[model samples]
Target: MSEVTTPAMRARPKRYLYIAVLIGLLSFLAYGATYPSMQAEAAPGTQASLEVDVDLTEWELNPSQFDFQQGDTVLFNITNSGRFSHNLEVSNTAQHLNSPTIGAGETTTLEVTLDNSGTYTIICAIPGHSDLGMTGELTVSGDNPAPAEGEFLGIPAMRLSPRNNTAVVGSSQEVRVTLHDFTLNADSIEGANVGGEGHWALFLDDELIASLGEPSYTLEGLSAGPHVIRAELRNNDGSAVEPALSSEATIQVPAAAP
Candidate 1:
């Protein structure tokens, strides 16, 4: 018996063809989605590179100068070509970067981002290393300008003893900040004369921690890291002086022995 050709029968085969095509497109899309990621994994992009070879015999660093663009990702490759061990420290008032101590025939890498454009000082953190001439310079060019000196009220001036970016962590640090053109009087701080200082406010990492009449203080309980100590001159009324005469120092703290 011969079957009759119906319009519905013809439509059924066309529906199956559409469904098959749809699935093929879905599979192609899934495969295409992973292509870029696979390509990226195969070949990564390169930024800027800096290579430094250190020798303790001469107490000198090769390629004493490095330059880069601000906001660029830079890879610092350091190799201790000398027999003695050495570490690297790059720091400024706002940030600090360091390399672990690498022994002779050892190489290390430090990835850094120069967030701002300025001159950065590099030195060996090992005791007496920097004095022996293990130092270098880094210059980053960018649109941002270097920080200007903070304005002061009257003749206010503050100088931190031992300076900033010089302290070691896990050790007792004695900080003496001398303030000129103002007298420190904590008792009568409230409503004190403008030029005559009351008590000084101490800030660590921008957090107010102490208000003391003396120009000296002891730093403790600091974890292993870099810290910024700031001192501000206040009026007798305990209010911050106008234009804010302040001084800040960055201190590096090392990890304590376990």
Candidate 2:
């Protein structure tokens, strides 16, 4: 016996087919929206955009620390969300890509390549900006090249201790400097290097404060605020080294009582 065909049966099959197609289309749309972000996170050197957000008033940076791989080309978009203009610079390393001074609420794009692999300090070079805590760090993954013999003018090295930027208000910030392959001598011994004898100059906010034969100095008479301390290896005649071998640290003094 032949079975009778019903319109309802045909309509139900169509309904299920339509529902399956709808779900497939929705899944494709969702994947398309999320795929780019996933790809960026998984691939370190992929073509992507990295953002650095800065707030001068609060002296804070978003994503204050980031990781980079050697040979990676990244587009950095630095945004100044504060009320003042600011610029960013990388210090204590040979890698040299920077953003210009960006005005308040303005954004700047900087394309940079990570050629060297090492820990780098990121700071705003606006004199007192770094003192207010506008700083961060970048950790790059790869091998950093070493200088060959005679490639350097002198055996020059420096270090700053108590590197963190916190200190008591109205008190002297004591900084210690360590030198390697370089000598600290008195003014009587300043000028050309004889037996590697030289001296060091202490700078506060880029201003030369004192020339010392010893490595320790007290930063005194500073108001309660952030300050940048720098130590430069100099020739006996008070001449700066070629390209300047130096080390720096930032200290923040707590506000004193009224």
All-Cα superposition RMSD per candidate: 10.9, 12.4
Quick one: how many clashes does candidate 1 have?
Answer: 7
Top model number, lDDT:
1
Off by over 4 Å in 1: 1-57, 148-258
Candidate 2: tens digits of C-alpha lDDT, residues 1-258: 999889998799899999999999999999999999887675644544454444433475665687877666666667888887676666443443456666678887767666677776777655467788888887878886433323444556666643544343466877677665666778544556664567888888889898988888887878777888888877788887665787776777777777
Which whole-number lDDT from 0 to 100 does residue 156 have in model 2? 68
Return the lDDT, model 1, position 96: 60
Give the alpha-carbon lDDT of every model.
0.71, 0.69
Ten residues in sequence with the least summed lDDT for candidate 2 = 145-154
Per-residue lDDT tens digits of candidate 1, residues 1-258? 999999999899999999999999999999999988888663343444544454433487776788887766766778887777676777644446676667788888767777778887788766567799899888988886444334343456555543546656366566677655567886776664756567788888899988888878887778888888888878777787776777776777888888
Clashes of each: 7, 3
